[model samples]
Target: MEFDISWILMGFPAAFVLGWLASRFDLRQLRRENRSAPKAYFKGLNFLLNEQQDKAIDAFIEAVQNDPDTAELHFALGNLFRRRGEYSRAVRVHEHLLSRADISKPERERAQHALALDFMKAGLLDRAEDALARLEHTPYENEARLSRLAIYERAHDWPQAVQIARLMHSHNQGDYSVRIAHYLCEQALGQQAQGQLDAAKDLLQQAQSEAPHAPRPRIELAHLQHKSGDPVQALGSLMALASVSPSSVPLVAPLMLELVKTDKRKPQVRALLVANYHSSPSLDVMQSLVQLDEFARVENADGPVGRDWYVEHLRHEPSLVAAGRWLAQETLSHEEHHPAVQRALDNAAKPLTRYRCAACGFEARQHFWQCPGCQSWDSYPPRRVEEQ
Candidate 1:
């Protein structure tokens, strides 16, 4: 053990010098890489800020080429491609990032999300859905599920939409009960179309259970009852709807008026309409009350005619629709030109009958449970444009 003292003393200094040289080499290499990536990245960022998207993409592509291991550069390049509508190139970039063995967990999830977006933009919905499904348990789960829900709705797959909606609800994403009810209603409509009335009824009942206050299920059930030759039951359902959802009286009023054929339910239905109109004044409710009054006149009840009902409605809301409607029935002094004046006023008031979406400003003559422009469920208010 005493013979190697000289060699051991000399070897320590040699090893230290060798280590220092190696460290310097590594530092120099690292610095060169740092310079290359940052220069290209900053150039790309500058171009992006200037709104020169094509030039920004070129700079990012160059940065990614200079540092192939830089995941952030790849993400930037991939997102740029996607935003520019170059789905093929975006898919290639994101897929390349996902295929790498050394990508971090967060980066991998990001790549998966980017890949899904690329497929969605490319209109490859099946691929996009599969890519999004893999994001469960990750931070992107909520966003992934929301996109999946949209896909399910766009494809008219109510079962799948219901599945995702239940998952979202369980996770406390938002109040999805109404959304679940809408899915059930859509399923019921499908069953009804297939001549499966019993199945449809079961679905509607489930929907009502899911969202008890939702108006569509109640309204739809009344329609089904009426079609089944059970006008009494139909009238009962609408009455229940009016009682619970007074705001929707306008929507149910016409149906109530139609169901009130005999004098037995005439007073009850009339009283309900008047009560609802007093609470929530609307053009639809007013018109229905007028129809009920007209019925009373035909049945030799002690009520005034339809035109007088409009005059009563005008007292509460000062509605142009009510005014125009009343003018239509009155006999003007200039009788010869009354027809032209009435026609002009009626044409002007026609737009007041439309239903407009609260979410997207889409207007339609018919009220919708979903907004066609924005694809939002229950976006249209129960009231017509004039009442709104």
Candidate 2:
């Protein structure tokens, strides 16, 4: 049969009209969807601003569902979940983002970082370490390395801490010399505990070299030397420490007193103690001097006698501790009540003898290089609480 050209011409306009109507319908639907996504997002933002987290999360979920390809929405949802302590949900959201191959490079790295944060917050340390390790050489490298360093420190993995610290130092991230020295000192302590004396000494020496002005390495080295039955080296280390870091002399005062059996160094030690005491007037250094003087009185008549150091300290500072020490040796007019007064004075001075953390104000009977409360290194000053 022959086709009618009129029929073909009639069908063209009809199809064109139908196609126009369909296109209009699709455009309207697309506009509705686009409007709904933003509406949901803005609603979630409003809820978040009002601190209604539950409603905000619901709105965010609705927005994400409507626009699943919105990477920012996914990030916001994941961060919210993490903030709310729903680490599993946060991890799932970030992992889903990572699974999608359509995301850009920066987005992918951001997702990885968020995923690592999720693992860290969930206390999955090994998984967190793995995730953070993948971020090396990325823009987030420094932050990841610092987090790993903290993890190593919290785990007492001093060797790993040292490694990361050296890397950060080499990269010019910050001056980590003191921190590296601390890590080496920690490693030396572990070695010393295991009876590896020589290895411990070597590590301590390396630590001292790393931070010449830091007092811990020298102090620890002196301890190791003393333990190895080498009083001469121990005295030398302490004496060098007094020269390098004179403010730390109080920490080594008792150790200096222990070296009195090496009588040849006694004059030098007494002079060292006197110089430190005169310069800083530390109660600890004064106590060491008094002890040395007590020993000296036994040998020669011309040696200094009694608790005159306490009187001199009182002359410098109106210290209750000095007064108590002076009263202990003084012959009071009312001798019967002296014991009661002394007991009261000792009780009152007990708190002053404690070491306080400069960062967290945590008081301890003994000094800590790291605060037990805040875990900050070198938080405690060398001086006692009263002195501080």
Candidate 3:
């Protein structure tokens, strides 16, 4: 320990210079990192806009690695993965965002929604349902509920569908009464198929109570009544159908004719059909009238004046179906070849009689409340293809 005050004083400035140099190095490193993150992000965006998804994904992954706390970049990457059908990667990216302690509340909810979508698009409905349930009360609540409704419908979970529909109805999201009615009717059909006749009847009645103006409830209820040895009630339901849903009168015309034949309510049934025909004339109703008139003539040697209503319908609409029916009933000079000619005409008119979906242009021989091809509700118009 000789006197060393000068050496100690020299060491202080050297230490100060070293500390300043170290601080400068740290700032330069931070700047380079900040610049690298943006470069990779912009590169990813450029690739995404060019439809070069694979390169975009690589660039995004690099950016995420460079700056892992970037929630926005993670979200974009997750969506990109989901769009590319890489559900596992998408789920991981979204879940990673969720695990971040620094993420904001809104961002956490957004990541949850993205994760739910990943499950949904991957067809993992059960997982998607649980994920969607967690989004209630958030900004994504209504959209989550809508997706949930669709999922329950596809799963044939009528009770769940009804619950969501009622919730949506109460919130004024959209009028769900008709949708609720259809769900009840679907449940009724399921019960009926399983030999639960009483349960089926109860469900159909509930469906009717839910939507009195809907046609399916009344039409299906009549089928149950007819099966239960109550032709009068069955006929009454159909009569109610004619008044409430005149456009659907054609669908049940043949059923009404059968009831009239069995129950001998010819006068009443004829009047109902006539009134409906005048309101909305259709080939189905017109054919039923001809059947009734032809049967009446054979039974009582008299029938309505418009037995040739087909000939009259042609006067206004030029309906090929009407023409075919009229020709089939007439006698030709070449009577032996008339069967061949009639067969050709009837076969040609069959497609015109089919129902067509207005939304998707899918045609079917039978009417559907929901189009099987497009999965759209009320897509098929009540009128047949020829009329439409």
Candidate 4:
């Protein structure tokens, strides 16, 4: 065959032209698809911006169908579903993302976190807890632990709450010493309820060591001791608390006076109460002083020490509680109507004696270490509502 060099040269340019045309065609097709995807996305965004949730969801669905590998779109859809209270659908979306083998580690963890949130929003606490537990070694560990802590607290699982709180503390999350002490105190209360007095005592001691300046553990321990017929030990605990947590002294003053009477430590306790009263001038401490002085007068035939104390308190501060107390014991000319007048004074003083939570403002006749209203530990100040 004769060599055809002219034909070969002509065929090379023709083939090159064909290849260029095919490449251009393919690029145009790709550009069209890319443009369509963004158009659908923007349609969804417009619908969302217009508060047309149903239309927006439809647009997003179309976009996701067009690009099945869009992880960010899937996440957005899942969150939208969760926000709209469609938790089951949200869980399905996130779980589908998690089950995909092609997802990266970070994406998988994110999917898991999203699924946990879905379960949490749906009120499936057990499933949420399990999902959150799997995120412990991931970047979401701290957030997961905090959520888990909230879950355990809601369930009143003190041991689990304490464990998570300690982990967070070790990780430098925050100062959880006070919370840890509260947990221990809760555990002690549980043990006491179950008739495990010795175990309760040990837990309370551990709580005291955990937060030396916290008032709850010592106060609780004093109550336990008083219940166990060890008034002397109870008084000692109160005395220790007065030194360590002086701000809480008012909360325990009445109990301190009762312990003093029961334990025959009147003189020492009376001195301490008088000193605290002078320093803080709390109504509780004043009432305790009055009781102690009345008892002392009965025991030693001394004249009224507390009547003068109340009158002197009125001199320093114009306290309604102090005035009421002073008036209750005074002899008026209209002594026949004194009972009715005393009833009115007692009624007026009732609200001032309630303890209130600082975080939630929950008032109660008894003091609380944890707020029943907000489930916050140590939210209640160790002061009466009026004092606060």
TM-score of each model, in listed order: 0.91, 0.94, 0.93, 0.85
Instruction: Please list all clashing residue pairs in model 1, or write none if there are none.
Output: none
For candidate 2, the 10 contiguous residues with the lowest summed lDDT are: 297-306
lDDT per residue as tens, model 1, 38-82: 999999999999999999998998898888998999989889998
Clashes of each: 0, 0, 0, 0
| Candidate 3, 242-330: lDDT as tens digits | 88998988888989988888777788888788788777778888889888887765333332344568876887787988898888778
Candidate 2 ranges beyond 4 A from true positions: 298-306
RMSD of 3: 2.5
Better of 1 and 4 by TM-score: 1
lDDT of 1: 0.87
lDDT of 2 by residue, 65-110 (tens): 9999999999999999999999999999999999999999999999
Q: Rate the local accuracy (lDDT) of all candidates.
A: 0.87, 0.92, 0.90, 0.86
Better of 1 and 3 by TM-score: 3
RMSD (Å) per prediction: 3.5, 2.2, 2.5, 3.5
- Over 4 Å off in model 1, which ranges? 1-30, 298-305
Question: Largest TM-score belongs to which candidate?
Answer: 2
Ranking by TM-score: 2, 3, 1, 4
Question: How many pairs of residues in model 3 come into backbone collision?
Answer: 0
Among all windows of 10 consecutive residues in model 4, the one with the lowest summed lDDT is 296-305
Please give the lDDT score at residue 84 for candidate 3.
98
